[model samples]
Target: MIPTSKPHNPNFSSGPCSKRPGYELTQLDISTLGRSHRSDIGKSALQQAIEQTKSLLKIPADYKVGIVPASDTGAMEMMLWSLLGKKPVDVCYWESFGKGWFSDIKNQLQLSDVNPLTADYGQLPDLTLTNPDHDIVFTWNGTTSGVKVANADWISEQRSGLTICDATSAVFAMPMDWEKLDVTTFSWQKVLGGEGAHGMIILSPAAVERLESYTPPWPLPKIFRLTQNSKLIEGIFTGATINTPSMLCVADYLDALNWITEIGGVDAAIARSENNLAILTNFVNQHEWINFLAERVEQRSNTSVCLRLSLTDKQLKEFGQLLADQQVAYDINSYKDAPSGLRIWCGATVEAANVELLLPWLSWAYESVKNSD
Candidate 1:
């Protein structure tokens, strides 16, 4: 059975992370529970979320922010299917999600000339190799590997190609250079700690033009299509979901966004995340048994902090099992595609104190397991 009490402890899993202050599963006004999402009340709450997101993130006034389907993956596919046919594609892969997109480009789209520039986990592809003439796809943060792009200076502002970014783990946790990103996607369940099933997609003027001027030969699914009646559906960005949405989830997201605003906007939230990461970094440095998975400090992720144990594979497996027995955190193991390690979510919702507590537990787990070995 799932634990009935909230852990008097911190949660460190990467996604579906911890909740913000004043968060309560039973606190929602159930009177609005049964109303149709198309109802004015539902629409108003969603609109508030969009507006709050815009204000908090300092997104430019001209960009369109839409509540799309399938969380980040859905939003990204919508952009990919709708926008990629216009130009040759150049995709950079440094982690699992990037590889997932590459698979989509190869097996799903089956594009003949797609250029995939890949790097091992915990590293970045050479941005200098990216050609401005072709559509560019990359993740702003590699959630699985704990590596993130530090800046967007490498991207040409005047480039003809569209720049698509999967920033699910980066948004709200770090500063994003909106001017450098043509299309960006994020999920509510990430940094915001809201329920999933919805994604926010922001589109620049260039992205809008691509959507209007180009249509893929492939059949467009209703959920993935961003255009209607030969025009981009600007209303979708303002609470008009492509299909129906879970109103409860929408309300939860609004609550999370409001909580973010209360604590100070994106900058404060980013600082909180950075502080959590710093705690882990300091602990990692002092502990000889563990080290960051990211090869360089610059590449380390502020949101998802991945680390590896100082042990051989067989010993590491046993040590991980012991840590699980302690019930400190579940799913701390690295992604199967990534090198073996622990991945900790250091998002805004995670308390710095909780992470600090866990540092000792990690060391205890390491020592106990080593003694057993």
Candidate 2:
């Protein structure tokens, strides 16, 4: 039997995740709607977002945080196209997003000294293989397979290379060491559950130096240009967007940021996500057929909580659909490249109590499917 009460919020998609609890469209008005983003009102809102991100993430004092175009992908690619090839690169991967980067470095940039460090899904590559002299690119969390880099201890503080991280899904939901990372990027669509199409890029002093001193061989599009005539663009860091932005989306993000402050800040957000993961962990511990996609407990993502099931691909798809059919869950299907099973977003916005309620529904769907088969 399906549970009588549903999750207070049923949005579990990994991207553009459920907005903060009590979110309403009315809460997002900032009096800048339909105004040019270059205007004072629009620029003030944009700069507020940059400052808000810095306040919540506690970025390094010397780092420059800028709002960029095309979500996380755009911010990352801009850095890649603008900064790579100055040194050898050590690209690491454990899942689909990592593979995409690998392709870009190999096929797109075609760097001569690129070294591929890889591992199967649900596992991690050897961190020690990254050469200090080589620029490194990696995703801090694998959204598809639900595995994340445990920490940044493997990185050397004295390394010459810039450690660029695509931390879209992990930020605000996990602990990050600013001292260890040189460049990091994330979109508003993930942990904060804000609108998409805009990305935030944080650059340490070393990263800013690279942009000012060295330029890649490739031609940078207008959207990807970060430096001009040997100087970093100061205006972009202060909320001068490269293109027109959705004022409504910007307002929504501001609302989410304010909610983050109300809910005890970043540490509180991490604890909430961890608590949600704990609730799901306890349920998974009792289920024999369902297991974590990430083999190592330490590597498991508390946000994008992926699971591997004993059922076949078709069975898993049907199960995912059944849960959605009953309005018990939504968008719980495995990622396209991952083994078929379930992927649940247990990010900060997800209440632990809602996770607890969803457990019995899992049992209901599983049993009903098994009996039907």
Candidate 3:
């Protein structure tokens, strides 16, 4: 039987996710549209974006937050190129992005003392293997595999090395221990439902110290350079960006941050995402044919909820198309490199009621695909 009701908004691509409920393009302030990014108005808006991000995330005053280019990938590379090579490194990977970082560290950067700690999709690498004396690179949340680190407990507090984390999908939707992380990178396009081409990098004081003291042997591009003559570039954190930022995108991000504030900040955003996950969890519990990609419940991601359905690979493709054809869901297919499954965006921007509505459609799609001749 076809479901009588459908989600009011069906824009659930994992990267751009869904917009906040009641979001309107007309409501965004576009005064700085044609102005130079270096203009006072543009700089002020960028600074506001930075300050509000710090306040909402409760980032320490000593820590630095800066916006950079190429989404989270850019920010992560900047740190990778700038701060590495001073010590032995541990590259932990479970998903595509983490694997990409590992490749860059070993093959691209050609670091001699790099150690790879790896796990297949649906499982977490042995984080316990991380040495306190070596720089550690890992993703806080495996966005493609639906796995996430349960906590920062595996990271040693007294460790001398820096912990670099790619937290693109986990920042707003999950609780992160700032002190446990030395460098964290995310993007506006994830949980916040903002535009792309802009990334955010949060650096602890220790990360800053490393930037000031150690210079990589490679040539630093203008966009990736964080230090000038061994002194940290103070303006980058304060909103003087290395390249021109899209003011229109900045306006959209400001709107998202304001929405975060109105919804009672980070905790509320996290609860909303978790609630969406709970809705899916209940449905998965009722059905035997479906299972989460993440083997451990604690390791599962609340935002990018990847699931394995008891269906053939062709059936999986048809199942996604069936939902998409009905306008019930969009871009809910598994990532290309990941196993054939469904990846739903259960972030804060997605409403729980919509998630509830999406489940019956999943059931209908599965049945429809299975019953096909």
Against the unseen true structure, what C-alpha lDDT does each candidate score?
0.85, 0.91, 0.95
Choose the strongest candidate by lDDT.
Answer: 3
**Candidate 3 structure, TM-score to reference:** 0.99
Q: Evaluated with TM-score, which candidate comes out highest?
A: 3
Model 2 weakest 10-residue run by lDDT: 364-373
At residue 49, give the lDDT of candidate 1.
77
Better of 2 and 3 by lDDT: 3
**Model 1 — TM-score against the truth?**
0.95
**Tens digit of per-residue lDDT, candidate 3, span 12-129:** 8899878899999999999999999898999999999999999999998899999998899999999999999999999999999999999999998999999999999999988999
Pitting candidate 1 against candidate 3, the one with the higher TM-score is 3
Candidate 2, residues 1-373, lDDT tens digits: the string is 5579888877888987988888889777769998989999999999999999998989877899999999999988988888899999999999999889889988999988999899998899999989988899999999998999999999999999999999999999999999989999999999999999999899999999999999788888999998889999999999998888899999999999999999889999999999999998999999998899899999999999999877877777788888888787899898888888899999999888789888988887777676444
Candidate with better TM-score, 1 vs 2: 2
Query: How many residue pairs clash (N, CA or C atoms closer than 3 angstroms) in each of the candidate models, in the order given?
Result: 1, 0, 0
TM-score per candidate: 0.95, 0.98, 0.99
